[model samples]
Target: MVSTGITPSGIFHIGHIREILTGDMLTRAALDAGMEVEMIFIIDTADPLRKVYDFLAPEFENYIGHPIGAIPAPDGAGKPSEGGNYGEHFLSPFVEA
Candidate 1:
């Protein structure tokens, strides 16, 4: 089994691509070599928010040290939105892509 993990503290970025793709490539290579491989992607939603980023609202100060998956996602104005939690909000697009 091949495992890849990412902390969902902020938005997905290019750096994340490298790690996830590396795991995927390894899995593909092993499969091509006649090995049975299972790839698992782990999202560290239980990780705490370290700070309020420039892209996040000042209101997020209330969430510091709290688990990201338990807090609300930021809206366009950087305020908390009703859509979903921070982890899912940032991860959805990357996973969909």
Candidate 2:
């Protein structure tokens, strides 16, 4: 089995692309060689928020050490919003792409 994991602490970036692509390429190569391969992508939504980033509102300080998936997403003003959880808010666009 080939496995890759990502922590949903912030925006997905180029480093994330590299990790996922590396796992995918490895899986493809193994499959092409007639090896049975299963690829798993793990999203670490349960990880805690470490701090309030520069882009985040000061109110996010209250969420420090709390699981990202349990906190609300940031609004346009960088304050917590009721739309969705923090982890999913950042991960959805990456998945869609």
Q: Give the best candidate by lDDT.
A: 2
lDDT of 1 by residue, 1-97 (tens): 9999898667788778888999999999999999999999888999999999999999999999999999999999999998899989888888898
What is the lDDT, from 0 to 100, of the residue 79 in candidate 2?
96
- lDDT of model 1 at residue 75? 97
**Model 1: lowest-lDDT 10 consecutive positions:** 8-17
- Candidate 2: give the clashing pairs: none
Models, CA RMSD each: 1.8, 1.3
Give the poorly placed runs of model 2, Cα more than 4 Å off: none
Using all chains and alpha carbons, the TM-scores for the candidates as numbered come to: 0.83, 0.89
Name the TM-score of candidate 2.
0.89
State the lDDT of candidate 2 residue by residue for 1-97, as single tens digits.
9999898788889889888999999999999999999999899999999999987999999999999999999999889998999999999998898
Highest TM-score against the true fold, candidate: 2
